[model samples]
Target: MSAWLFDLGNSRLKAAPLGEDGLPGDVLAFAHDGMALAAGWDSVLPPRIDAAHVASVAAPALRVALLDALAARAGRISLASTQPAWAGLRIAYAEPAKLGVDRFLTLLAARRRGGASLLVGVGTALTIDLVDAGGRHHGGRIAPSPTMMREALHARAAQLPAVGGGYRVFAADTGDALASGCLGAALALVGQSREAAVDACGGPVALLLHGGGAEALLPHLADAVHAPALVLEGLACWARPDGARR
Candidate 1:
């Protein structure tokens, strides 16, 4: 592939090839860590990548390092940023730049389906955004994600383990309780947002679920679409010749 797409999130880095259909193909994920900066990245990277498009919600240092590495291989590199509006989608933020580009791009990709929709991204944070059929954004909410909640609890209370637990309807153990509570909180938010979107749009709204933590919520969330790389999908869109800002 001539064009490469990179999505750098707080916890991970994902890359894929930009297909002829303007969508990403076969995503590859890498864990984010200070050690092993290069970490066999060059081994997996495409040999003749000509241009690279990136959407980053990672630290500035990570972004610089990743972009610099890509720059060495690709002649052109475009970093996506939040905009007031793009690709027929208008952001609800009064100061649009304050909105995260991952959120922005996810909305861009979601609204392209041409209907009322709610976007629920489960990552370092759980971000929710609503958009109507016409691509008019109706704002969103942000909260600590299930994983973050677990981490916070573990940090504050020594006995709580951050990593071991499974969501259950009724937890008989503390670990299960923590997992259930955190995940249930996210589910409730999505449920409420779906109802609100239905009322606001005067019709049923499709819920698009994305990010690393999305799968755990999937079996519980009926009538929802799982998009593991929605941000990368939007990066592909933004990489288009016409989608680029002047």
Candidate 2:
């Protein structure tokens, strides 16, 4: 059966189809409303997809609308949750139900690729989760994205110009200094978390990075696996024959 996957992240909504065609289609990112992204799903499906899997961290009502739309087109649909499952991947969260589905899926993807991996999702917000060697999901950290950091400085503080993504050793002067401060700080938080997870896990860890900032931030990641489609891949696995974990 074909698989359609959706990851509802903090900033954008991402969807993918799993098949023999190689890579999943380009990820579509839109505001958390789900309106703009939902409209495009139907047009992209080839003959017809057999199944759909959605892992949403958005509000229940928003998820309901998106699920209704997908169910109307594809009959088999699975909604991911943070609940502890009987099998598949072991969840280590004290309260798995409160954990974000996207984060769980990301950990699953990292485990499938290789255990003890650091899953970093850099979208509207930056998230760094660790799957320990013993198969426990040790949760993760969240920080404002590079873009958000830049925008916040501008919006909240005076004389803080808005800046885009770029690489610099760390700014020395005001404009470049502020831009570098925002971007560098964001990356530093993510990188440090990844390192901490590795240390805490007591072994080498594979770093998987994904989301809207993947392309822009890939270069800055000197020690990451650079799996830009991680969320999509995890979504595909969630829709697979044995997709859930305990």
Candidate 3:
């Protein structure tokens, strides 16, 4: 089947073909704002696809627009939702619906790695989730990502630029200081989460990072596995025939 996986996030739309081995092929990402939606997909997606499996954490309007676009090109479309328990990975949420599907799908991919993991997603928001070797979730934390922090600070104080500067332990300039402070906050949170996960899981936990901003934090973290296409990988799992039972 010529199936494709779509991960619609807060700022961008990521798509990839699902290979026979149940992994995502080369990923293609598009910004959902400013550009004409139809034009963006038209230039990138194939002429037609047999199936399109989507996991969206975008705004409702954007989600509806994506579905509309897919309707014209795909024979079948499946939307992934958070499940309390599926394929051995159990959620920690009392109300499963409240959990973002991106985080849920990230956990699905993390569990497949077969070990205790601390999954951190750095996008518009920084999300940290921990899953044990047994596929049991121990909950997570969410906060404004460094990019968002910069944007927020810029909004309040126009002099602080929203998008430049290198991360430093102690920056002499305002831009670098902003970068350092915001990124440091996220790094600290991840560090704390890893420590907590180690205590809860009774051993050292694997650290997995994903999302658009993950690359920026990679240098500071040792032995962290960067899986930029994790959500799409999870979507690939959901697209499988035995996905629900696996």
Candidate 4:
């Protein structure tokens, strides 16, 4: 059976449908309003859908609203929580439930990637999750995207212009300088999180990176494998009882 995976974040809603083989068949990213059949939301969808799951970092009311919207279009819907699933991997957040669905789903997907992993979800907001070999999911860090970093700086201060574009390791000019500075900041945050995970677990942590921002964010992180379908893989894992590898 096919399954739908939704990573609902602040800026946009990322949805993908996975085929029986546990790989993404179709992908769609739309503005939050588009997905909502309600008043003001941009909605995007495939011609048809089967079962669907949502990992939402939205508020309770908003979550219920979005669930209601998806339920109208899809057959079955499951809302994932930070409360432990698949045995170990207890979410170690102060308010575990408040953890972003994308972050939690990334960790769930990381289960198959293997233990002692550094899970990174790069989108409008970037998140890093650390799962030890024993399946203990000690939480990681969160930061704005490279663009958002510049945007925040511009918003807070005055002179800095809102910057956008990919990162460069060796910036030669002004554009590259801005991109590299923002990129370096994001990489530093991700690297520090991975280093901390390695120190705590006393083993090398495998890196699994995904999300809309992956194209721009992956270059800066060292030795990170890009798995764009990680959320879909995790959704397939949740849908099927018999183990299937993606």
- Among the numbered candidates, top lDDT falls to 3
For candidate 1, the per-residue lDDT at 152 reads: 94
Error of 1 at 35 (Å): 6.7
Give the range of the ten consecutive residues with the poorest summed lDDT in model 3: 34-43
Candidate 3 off by > 4 Å: 34-38, 243-246
lDDT of each: 0.88, 0.71, 0.90, 0.71
TM-score versus the correct structure, for each prediction: 0.95, 0.83, 0.95, 0.78
Give me the displacement of residue 95 in model 4, in angstroms: 3.9
Error of model 4, residue 123, in angstroms: 2.2
Tens digits of per-residue lDDT for model 3 on 1-246? Answer: 799999988778898999988899999988767233535564678889999999998778888888989999999999999989877899999999999999999999988778999999999899999999999999999999999999999999998999888889999999899999999999999988888999999998999999999999999999999999999988887777864654
Give the range where candidate 2 is weakest over 10 consecutive residues by summed lDDT.
32-41
Clashes of each: 0, 2, 0, 8
Error of 3 at 192 (Å): 0.8
**Per-prediction CA RMSD (Å):** 1.7, 3.1, 1.5, 4.1
Q: List the residue pairs that clash in candidate 2.
A: 85-246, 89-245
Better of 1 and 4 by lDDT: 1
Candidate 1 lDDT by residue in tens digits, 1-246: 499899988878899999998889899998867433447875798666889999987878888889888877897898999988887888899999899999998988886667888999999899999999998999999999999999999899979989877889899999899999999998998899888999999998889999999998999999889999899988887888873642
Q: Mind sharing the TM-score for model 2?
A: 0.83
Ranking of candidates on TM-score, top first: 3, 1, 2, 4
